[model samples]
Target: MKRCGVGSKNQAKLQAVASVFAEVDYDVQGFDVDSTVSAQPFSDEETKAGAISRAKAVLEKDVEIGIGLEGGVMQMNDGLYLCNWGAIADKQNHVFTAAGAKILLPEEIANGLHRGEELKTVMDLYTNRHGVSHEEGAVGIFTNGVISRADMFIHTVRLLYGQRCFYLS
Candidate 1:
């Protein structure tokens, strides 16, 4: 079986990626690795750089396929938001990337987050609800359940892998 190494031990992220490639007959494996960039990556270029860094770290293990998932938030004029990015690097040095959907935040919440407050804290302060992290809400308290971040990551990976497969064959 072809083996693919994922850059995180987060079960949810791993499962999402695995489900997408499962249809293609690849054996997906998850590993614990730091996916952080030296600097915060709020833009596409920086985010891609972070993903590449993680992929390179995984490649050091000599895996046939290396996968990295990165989550970043940027502040727009309106508010803060979530940006999830993924990268796939093959042993031959071919790299493919996909970005998950963006989730915008409210202005007040964005300011609070920029001050280093946790999402859960912000949610509780704004909604008086507990455990209301991004994992609970699609974007923020105002927009909950409108989308699934996990689904976004899965879909992105599937699309990227599809494109990469064509080149590999």
Candidate 2:
């Protein structure tokens, strides 16, 4: 099986990729790598950059494919929304990127993020739970369990996978 490396050791991200790749023939593993961006990305561009950075950084582990996922809050005219991005990279320097759905965060959560707090921390404190990022995530919490963090990333990964397969083929 071809080796696939993921940029983050986060369980949510690993599971998202593994669940998808399980349908294929790739061996997926997670690695602790730097995103090379601020812990809290405030814009879609920054979030996308973080994903691409992680995807490329994890490729150095000698895997045939590398994947990266990032979660952040973005400010739009309506309000601050939770945003997720995913990227796939190959040894040939080909990169595929796709963004997940954006959900408008509660005013309190947006306020916290605007005040220089990370989404993980803000969500945990807002929900009075620890490790919210690893668990249901802001999407799950906001949607009242209708969607999960992994589910959102899984869709993004699927988009990346499809694009990669199409172009590489």
Candidate 3:
């Protein structure tokens, strides 16, 4: 089987990529690669940059394709909204990127993020849960489990894959 790499050890992210590439016959694997961005990106641009960085980093592992997923919060006049980005990079260095759905965060969560706390930490405290990021994530908590973090990343990966196929065609 051909190799495809995900630039994250996060189980949810790795699973998302695996599920997407399963029908395509790629041997999906996850790697612990640095995103080369903030631990908690505060804007859509930085979040996308992190995803692209990871995607490119995974290329060093000799995979034909590399994927990266990143989640963050973006501030707007209305409120802070959760943001997610994904990127796909091929050996040719061609990159495809996409963003997932966004949802407004509650004031408390926003405040904690503004106070320099990572979303995973603040969300765990707010929801009184552990490993929420690896599980349902803030999107799941806020959306009442309507969309888990993995589900969100799955959608993002699909977008990236579709974009890649489009460009290839």
Candidate 4:
């Protein structure tokens, strides 16, 4: 069995990546490292640099595969938007990255975040609640158990798997 290292401690992200590669017969390993490169990557070079940082961190372990996911908000002509980007690297030092998915931010939330307020704090203030998870029932779901961030993350993992050159055919 091949070993793949994921550059995050977040269980959800790890599980999502594992589930995607399970079909290809690879064992997934999760590791904690400084995946943060920059909160704002406006250009392609900056974005790829961030992903490279993450990929290199995991590659240091000499694993067959390394994966990283970075999520943040980027400013656009319209407003701030959420972007989720990922990268996969092999022991040969080859790397591939998924194109970012952008989600438009509500003006109020964007302004709050710009003012140094954390996203969760802004969500709490607006929703008049505390500690709402981004999971199934918290904010990700739309209908009753109909949607989830996990689902989104899973889709991301699948996309990455499809693009990953190291995956078994």
Q: List the residue pairs that clash in candidate 4.
A: none
What is the C-alpha lDDT profile of model 1 across 14-97, one tens digit per residue?
A: 777789877777788787777666334556666667776676668776468888876667766766777777888987889988
Among residues 3 or more apart in sequence or in different chains, the pairs in candidate 2 whose N, CA or C atoms overlap within 3 Å are none
Candidate 1 lands at a TM-score of 0.79
Best by TM-score: 2
lDDT of 3 at 122: 97
Clashing pairs in 1: none
Among the numbered candidates, top lDDT falls to 3
- For 14-119, candidate 2 gives per-residue lDDT tens digits of 8899999978988999999999889999889999999999999999997999999998778899999889899999889999999999999989988888899999
lDDT of 4 by residue, 16-116 (tens): 78778877898888887776565545444555566557766898875788887765566888987655667888776677777454567788878987887
lDDT of each: 0.70, 0.91, 0.93, 0.67
lDDT of 3 at 80: 97
lDDT of 3 by residue, 60-107 (tens): 997999999999889999999999999999988799999999999999
Which 10 consecutive positions of candidate 3 have the poorest summed lDDT? 14-23
Candidates ranked, most accurate by TM-score first: 2, 3, 1, 4
